[model samples]
Target: MKSNVYMFLLGTMCLLLLSCGEEKLPKPRAMLRLNYPAPVYEDLDMDCSYTVKKNKMVQIKNAKYTRPCWYNMYYPDLKATVYLSHYEIKNNLDSLLRDAQNLTMEHHIKADGIKNKEHINEEEKVYGTLYIVSGNAASPYQFYVTDSIKHFVSGSVYFDARPNYDSILPAANYLQNDLMHFMETIQWKN
Candidate 1:
């Protein structure tokens, strides 16, 4: 009986010693690494009175006519949507500009920070501001491009799930890149 007790205690001590091989510590915070394929874009032309390049990954859906040129760029794989609305500038530049800025600011309550980047493509006559909302906001990105006279195109990206940046950041980033591409390739049509 003494030998058996001694053997059991010795075995337990050995495990305790070996277990110290790797110092066990709480895991540090980590983020997921998402990699997407090289994106392909196609010319999105229609009766909407404007043209923009859209990611081939996104499926264009004709949203219920808010006006005439409203469209939704849907990412089925990412479960995200980029809401797009185009307006013909008819002396409502101030109103339209104010509305676009207001829409982005609406996410301020839940956003940690908001960054606005000016987008200018003098050749394409597309000028706009890109808003990147950082945090648990519903809309992580928003922008509006215009000729500053006859065309105003705006967009905002939203995910269908709860506003958890960790889970949604990858998807938001993908969509945001697509939005920037769209703005960069925008052209107003008559």
Candidate 2:
């Protein structure tokens, strides 16, 4: 009789422990809202113009605008498109490239706690570099600087979901190449 009672108590305790374990699982949180620059496309008819910042690294010559689409699976319910901000001259293009390098490095360091993957590609243009970051939950962000137009352009695609803490390389390359294309299309207004 005692042996049977002991076995019963042990089984009951095991059942209770299993129930408690299930209750301890974490619940999923709500998606975070992403924040980025509000795109300014005042000149939709003619190519949009961008003003040179104090650095004079690049100026907006003209940009072709396209409405962002929902087809992009990585970034659901968010809008995104290529912006072609052009610049003139190559005098400070080298400095712009250097700045891009520093900016990318800082971004990587900051994201080290999360998803952080990056690659740098040069020789695609006469004097330019493209940086790409990709990952599972995050969309890629790109930066491209060029000596041909003295321009450094940056762009990124982000999603409503928390980016996967891995695989940040694809988005990085996408944005960088797009910026380089924009620089290539720039025409000097002066």
Residue-level lDDT for 187 in candidate 1: 81
What digit string (tens of lDDT, one per residue) describes model 2 on residues 25-102? 587876554443332322222332232211112223323344221112122223333333334445876665566566
Residue 80 displacement (Å), model 1: 0.4
In model 2, the Cα lDDT at residue 175 comes to 39
lDDT of 2 at 166: 40
Total clashes, candidate 2? 19
Q: Candidate 1, residue 184: CA error in Å? A: 0.8
Q: Which pairs of residues clash in candidate 1, taking residues 3 or more apart in a chain or in different chains?
A: none
Residue-level lDDT of model 1, residues 1-190, one tens digit each, is: 9999999999999999988786778999897777776789999886777887888888889887857888898988888888888888899999999999999999999999999989898887789999999999998999999999998988888888999987888877787788788878888776
In model 1, what lDDT does residue 161 have? 93
What lDDT would each prediction earn against the true structure? 0.87, 0.41
Q: Candidate 2 — what's its lDDT?
A: 0.41
The candidate scoring highest on lDDT is: 1
* Model 2 segments more than 4 A misplaced: 1-86, 110-127, 134-139, 145-152, 160-162, 166-190
